[model samples]
Target: MRRRIHAFSAVLALLFVAVFWISTVVSELFLSAAAVAQVKLAIAYALLGFVPVMMLTGASGFALGGKGRHPLLLAKRRRMSFIVANGLFVLAPAAVFLSIRAQAGSFDSVFYSVQALELAAGAANLGLIGLNIRDGIRLGRRRI
Candidate 1:
């Protein structure tokens, strides 16, 4: 049951990352006022949905690790830590800021620079989470 829960949570996290990336790309491509408002609404909804999914993913990961000292588990934990920190400290705030700036009709060079940084950070998070998922699978198979 724990294994199943962990697998489910990991898949959920992956799906969340994919959706976020898609939304980011779509938001970037459509910059009109109507499109911006719609994209902002989508982003807001995504953020609301992401919080609980991330919490479940982390909790299930911890439950699976359960004080074990396996190297793969440790690596997975570290990657998850990076994801959480980056999401909370960087991506979320940047998204909110960008949305506010868009609503305010401000799209200067600084906004683009910040958006680029946010995209990079988000991409990093996705990559790390993918690695973590691979590690988790290896740990499950006793191949780590």
Candidate 2:
């Protein structure tokens, strides 16, 4: 059951990350005001889902770690920590700021810059999480 839950949470995390990345790309590529508004709304709604999914991901990851000293496990934990920190400290705030600017009908250069930074940070998170997932699968296979 725990293994199933862990797998489920990991999948959820990956799904949300992919959605966040694709949405950012779509919003950037097509800069119509209506498109921007719709994308911003989608992103805002995604955040509502992202937060809880990430929480579950973190909780299950820690539970699975189980105080082990395996190198892959340690690496996974470190990567997860970085991803979580990036999301909370950087990505979330940028998204909120962008959403507010969009809501207020402000689409200045600053907004674009923020969006770019958010996308870059998100890409980094995606890569790191992908590595962690690979490490997780290896750990599971080894039963360690």
Candidate 3:
């Protein structure tokens, strides 16, 4: 049951991050300023769901593997640590700031600068999450 919960939470969180990253990129590339603003606001609003999902993911993952010192679990936990930190410190703040800037029609250098940072950070999180998922699959396969 715990394993099921962890798997579901992890996948859900991954989907949330992927959608945020993809939407942001597509909006920036082809959409208008108003569209970008809408995307920004939408991402921010989505965080309401994303944040708790992440928390559940972490809690359930830790409950399942926190005591294990195996290399794969270690790797997953380390990646998760960075993932959580980046989500909290960098991504969330950038989303709010970008949302405000976009709403104000202030697509200045600072906004773009932060947007780039957000993209890079989001990409990093996506990769780390993918790696963790891969490691998790390996661990499960080993046990089976």
Model 1, 1-144: lDDT tens digits are 878887887788778777777776786786566676567556766888887888888998887788988988888878888899999998888878877877777778877887798889988988998898888878888933
For candidate 1, give the lDDT of residue 130. Answer: 85
Worst 10 residues of 1 by lDDT: 31-40
Candidate 3, residues 27-138: lDDT per residue as tens digits? 9999999999999999999999999999998998888775888899998999999999999999999999999999999999999999999999999999999898889888
Candidate 1 wrong stretches, greater than 4 Å: 30-33
TM-score of each: 0.88, 0.94, 0.96
Model 3 spans > 4 angstroms off: none
What's the candidate order when arranged by decreasing TM-score? 3, 2, 1
Supply every candidate's count of residue pairs whose N, Cα or C atoms clash at under 3 angstroms.
0, 0, 0
lDDT of each: 0.80, 0.85, 0.92
State the weakest 10-residue window (summed lDDT) of model 3. Answer: 135-144
Cα lDDT of model 2 by residue, 14-109, tens digit: 888788779778776877776786777777778888899889888888887889999999999889889989999988888888888887888899
**What pairs collide in candidate 2?**
none
Which candidate leads in lDDT? 3
The per-residue C-alpha lDDT of model 2 at residue 9 equals 80
At residue 16, candidate 1 shows an lDDT of 78
